[model samples]
Target: MKPDIRGRQPANRRQKGAAAEEAAAQHLIQNGYRILDRNWRCRTGELDIVAEKDSVLVIVEVRSRSGSSNFGTPSESVDRRKMQQVRSTAEHYLHVKKQYGRPIRFDVIAVMLNAELTTASIEHIPNAF
Candidate 1:
């Protein structure tokens, strides 16, 4: 397991993150959201999922935790600083994409994965911010 730049997380962490994001996206799709983007990145940060539902643009932040819930729930991990970063990134996306004057909503999709990473349970919170 190769460490990332700061040597804090192993490469498998990324794989798990990707898997969690995929699960979150599928959950959204099943709920009638049209996915516009996944892993949208810019200088500020990354937006995990961008979707549209009922003419409202939804910015989804996907969070996941595996194994025991010793630390906390996944959605609880998104603190104030992270919310600022997501808002900044979303602004950048809106300006770049020229999507102006559209209703927007922020959502959080929390996924809990089993130890073996075989299944995921998801909780979708709309207007999370």
Candidate 2:
């Protein structure tokens, strides 16, 4: 099996993550954010979603949880370490794309999927950190 960046992930988990990201992207679009990139990679890490609205560049982190919320909400999963990684990656992205001197914001999108993966609940938190 081909392993992902974090290591080998079960097919179902990967699929669910992909679905969640897609839903997040769609939600952003629906809310008038223009998507700049998805799954952007750098030496630091990957940016789940990069978008822009009213000339402000937005860095979005997407987290997904299935079934119960026993472990906690998906947004709570993005701790300091993960935020640092996202920030580092966003810096690399700005440098590489020459998007300097622009306003920036960090956002977290939590997606909760039902057990059958037929429906999802999305929560968007702007200026998350």
Candidate 3:
């Protein structure tokens, strides 16, 4: 499972993810994306970050890989099942609010971490699976 970054996160890849998310959030803010929620969850799944950009619902997925020793690339880990869950969660969110007129998309935020789990780099892949 991924670490929670909404709260007090340790100084590791966990926080790296948070940093990437923070950067992405700022980018969105500057690019006119209004943040709706962060790390929202339900009984079925969770959405890492949710926001409204250009009148569209965005479901963000943040992934962190420490040196790629075992887990390969961060973006590569977000397989089909995870995307399905994100889509499902987005649908659930819309269903709960009865809002279904806006377009929805999936975004991937990849945070590269050093061997010690520190921040290496951040890559934001919008509309990525």
lDDT per model vs. reference: 0.91, 0.92, 0.77
Write down the worst ten-residue block by lDDT for model 3.
1-10
Q: Pull out the clashing pairs in model 2.
A: none
By lDDT, the better pick of 1 and 2 is 2
lDDT of 3 by residue, 1-129 (tens): 444566544466456667667766766787788989887888779888888877888888888766554857888989999988888888888888678787888888787766445567777888895
Q: What are the per-residue Cα lDDT tens digits for candidate 1 across 1-129?
A: 556577655437787798889899989999999999999999999999999999999999999898877999999999999999999999999999999999999999999987556446899999999
| Residues 1-129 of candidate 2: C-alpha lDDT, one tens digit per residue | 566677854359888888899999999999999999999998999999999999999999999998899999999999999999999999999999999998999999999987555446999999999
So what's the TM-score on candidate 3? 0.75
By summed lDDT, which 10 consecutive residues of candidate 1 come out lowest? 2-11
